[model samples]
Target chain A: MNKWTKLDNAAIVFPSLAKAKNSTIYRVSAVLKETVLPVRLQQALDITVKRYPMMTMRIHKGLFWRYMEYDDEPLRVKREDDYPCHPLQDRMTMEALLKVFYYQRRISVEVFHAITDGSGAMEFLKTLVYEYLRLLGKAVEPEDKIRTASEDIHPEELEDSFHRYYTPGRPPKIRNTKAYQITGTYFEPYGNNVTQGVVSASALRQIAKKQGATLTEFLLALLMYTIYRQSSQDRKDQRPIKVSVPVNLRQMFPSKTLRNFFAVALFEISSQQEQSLFKILCAIKEQSVKNYSKKVLQEAIVRNINLEKIKIARFIPLPIKDIIVKNRYFLYNDKLRTCTMTNLGRVDLPKTMTPYVDRMEVVFYPTANNPLNCGLCTVNDNMTISFSRTIRENRIIGEYFRYLSQEYGLEVKIYSNEWGISD
Target chain B: MNGGFQINHCIHCQVTVEASLQECPLCGKKLTNTRLSVPRSYPAYALHNKSSYYFQLFWKTLVPLMFIGAFLIPSLITLLTGEGDLWLNRETLGIASAWVLVRYTFLSRMHMGKKFLLQIMNISLALFIFDHVGEARGWSVNYVIPFMLICSTLAMMYIVYKRKRLWSDYAVYVMTLIFLGFLPSFLYLIRVTSLLWPSAAAAGFAIVSLIAVYFFLDKNFRSYFNRRLHF
Candidate 1:
């Protein structure tokens, strides 16, 4: 709430107008060698809440106007041994053991985009799981560096390591004039708030590397081709598509408040003609990497923040100011072409906790307000690009994943509730 | 100017008094002299068709007027039969007192004057109808017949105000029933009442003419009255 915290969170991002209501999921399944007490999970949540207090609350307002807090009780974990278990955690079922349910097992942590990005929340979750194990008397080494470190680290040092591991490729040349419509589709059976998880970080990186594409590019290509394929089957007008890719602006700006800290870079692909599975994926990868550079992200951040500062500087009241800004934002949206493709980088857990944990999977469900739902998942040297069919058709999600494993020579595994029959 | 109507000031109160008044009604003030001045309107809010206005007119105006007339009509008949002093002193004083109250309450507001007259005509006609119908059947007019007519009219008025439906919807039905049932009273009022024109038939036509003019008049009568009737 202070000036410094507000500046850190200024880059908070939303999906294109089309996918505004969408929420991404980051679900990790770890095999605890020993039983972990629920008390340990609560303690870990208490510690995390003390640190990043924004991740511990639910969205309170309507479809928009989101804020965050750490006041709510922590999210709960379910034990499979309990009869008639929650349908959400059925995949991570265990026969015998103590289940760690933080702040009572019935709570949920629904984060609005204004608060924290998926990467930030994933980090919080990783630390939480790690701390829970330590509380259970399991051999655990604490994360000393991040705990002691202040959030005022330099942006160059942060991106330097990222650049070393993954080369900052040229961003894609997006071509579109109209904005993508943002929307969401709610499934009653997803149990409170759940998104279908797929893709592993390693698998996507390897596939993206093989295709001479970055992980984001490969995913964007997959999304564009899948949508192109789906729309073409219906014999609809073959229109050029655009997807919104969120850019983290935490370092470029000078703060690390857990509130919104992201800008957006769009990736556009022309669907002038039908493209082969591999061809579209390659194009997507090239364009996405090119669009997601340091210069591009920084420019986007500066342009938006300056506009916001100028807008608020006007003497109009907050509500009227918000309306004018929103109307202007809408006017610019007509140039956008298609959907959204978000790629949260490799979810990293503590070095010492690898033995106790296996992998993490993230699933994204855009709101019914948005017409598209493409989720990215990366875990244990493999990646799965899962798309939800609640809004559009299932064939698009099915064919896209199928072609990734089939045509690309990538070993991809597809999992759904009731084998593609979303129940 | 000297022959025209003059307003007077009350001797005791020094308040501007009406030209017609011989004594001040307020503060027991007495009038000293008369002078010609414009008669200021009585500051009264009058709604002719509203239930409260109609009810007040009925209780304070119509009922008293009709009851006074009831005693006077029979007394006039008795006087015509050469019994002039038969109704004097006690009954004459009562009827006179009732008539004075009726005129002051109902005829004070100009907006309510026409509607009140029409209501009186309707009630008189209803009584005539009951009398005629009973005489034709060789039976005397029963108490229940007149009582029912009064009750029904009051009830219909109550409903009209309560529902707030358009006047054209249900107002026609109620008016039609009253007109059909009040034939004899129409004849009687016309024959006896000198100030109300010669006959009930003529009075009825005049009433209808007034109603048409009031509803269809291009002028805003409410605004006109509001201006002229300022306190």
Candidate 2:
């Protein structure tokens, strides 16, 4: 018999809204210096799977709720033949929520959001690369952060940290107001077109410091400014241009759980106000400094957990709960913000393994309504900013990178998934 | 126990081993006694037991209790009212059959063909019981069930046609539908049902569908059959 566990608080919304267009899946890939050997990769994955027990489970249906059970099926590593962030067909596959695919020197791990968040997925990817390097006869010593296959999986890694950190209090509700939305023609065959911009980490940091804002604040301001400039003018209704930024709670709270322990911070700027770049950056910096504070994030966490703790919500059956959750998510996506921007922050690896690995990138899938999303991660001073969009128009992505090169005087190497839109 | 060293290290990987071991787990390097004591880099923590008792209780105890109560409560109410008849018994059985149907549809982790077959059987059984208990009318065996079987077979065929690449995956399901399509004629022949048109219509449609696919879509049909039958 296999073991089973209840779905975590953050994961409860993903299973209901999972579809082709809105897969809620993300990818983190590591580019190695040598070509990937499939046999060695499979061997490494077999060993690594034992270390991450939570990643080996499958979602199961229960009487009042959906739970996850350990799936004993063998996981297979495949070649990358499909588009990035394709929906995980658990029923068709081995019932695993995450998949490993390799192409040339790159090894990618795509995980359904129901399993884990970006930070947790990155941990898995890092450990996988560690194991892969070891299998390849590379002298990869285990580091402080990397959990090797020989070590026992920690209890904290499997815990639902949200439940542990949730405090019962009357926290002010986050507003759900409509923001300026981007409209465009969707790509054919319903695929995500990823445009990755690789820039120098020190140079980007210098620019951020010069603007008197952090990298995240600077990027948020640029994203909002780009949207504000591109959005069509509707004289009757003027809404604020907003971007949803996911904050990793592990930094604020003392928890090492691999499950989702993150909160989203919505940053908005008035579209009607004619503001310069400096004014926008100042506004973003002020709001972000206040929002990213511990007190504000704790309030956000309390407000989110309070929804799950409602008396009526606890007793409601799974089917009804799914409907309620889906409706809440739909409303959140439609009215809460224009788009999402998630920063995985700097990823550090063991010194011994650095020679074998090149760099890393993170790609987030877009929702049906919000057709574009941005994910950023820095590895070995190579900051890769990935834009994943389902829309045909790449003007925003083009302009964003162009702004970095032309205005900011920073060299940005740009590439794309090349979805081949004839238009 | 040499006085020169208190630590064991792998000669190949050059990493210190925390536990007593004969070989290095990472590179199969033989352990050797070393003079320097190196601290273990990994944390000392027991692996968390993955078993969840709450999930076990919900699935093993609560779900079965709910399944039983769905039938038991209604029957108990019917009996306690002192207005019991064959109707209550039939209703209880119908509810139980409906529960089985729903359980197989949503809960059972069976293949698509097995689920479809189970659904067909459950629906037919429920209709048979209802027809027998209500008025002994042959409408269930006569028109309803045969029509349902033929319509479902057509739907499955249409689905297979639409998903041409997955025709092999649905071949067994289509074959099962064809086998079920012949079942209504058996009922008619056994004198359990008096209606001949419905059975003939269902069987005829199944035969025609089989012939059409085999003749018109010969290449796909042969490929699907060969792959599904493992020939």
Per-candidate DockQ values are 0.01, 0.02
lDDT of 1 by residue, B1-231 (tens): 111123554433333344544444333334566332433111111232124445665777787678757777777777688765663434554455445545544544422223443454444444544445444441222333333444455555456456542222234344543453353345345543222222334335435534643575324334323322222
Evaluate model 1: give its TM-score. 0.48
Fnat for the candidates in order: 0.00, 0.00
Model 2 off-target regions past 4 Å? A90-94, A232-237, A420-423, B1-231
Clashing pairs in 2: none
Name the best candidate (by lDDT).
Answer: 2
Please, what are the lDDT tens digits per residue for candidate 1 over residues A1-423?
310112122422232211223333323233233344665666666665555544443321112222221233444553322111122221111111112232211212333343356556555566666666666776766565243112433333212122122222333443447633432343322222222323346655776787787777766777777777666654444546667776665555554433445666766655666577577776665665566676777555555444434543434443454565455455555336455555566545557765665334444444433444554645444443444333323455555555655565444433232211221
Write model 2 residue lDDT over A171-208, tens digit each, in one string: 77655678877778986556777767667888899999
Give candidate 1 regions above 4 Å deviation: A1-37, A54-109, A143-176, A179-207, A250-257, A285-289, A311-314, A321-337, A417-423, B1-231
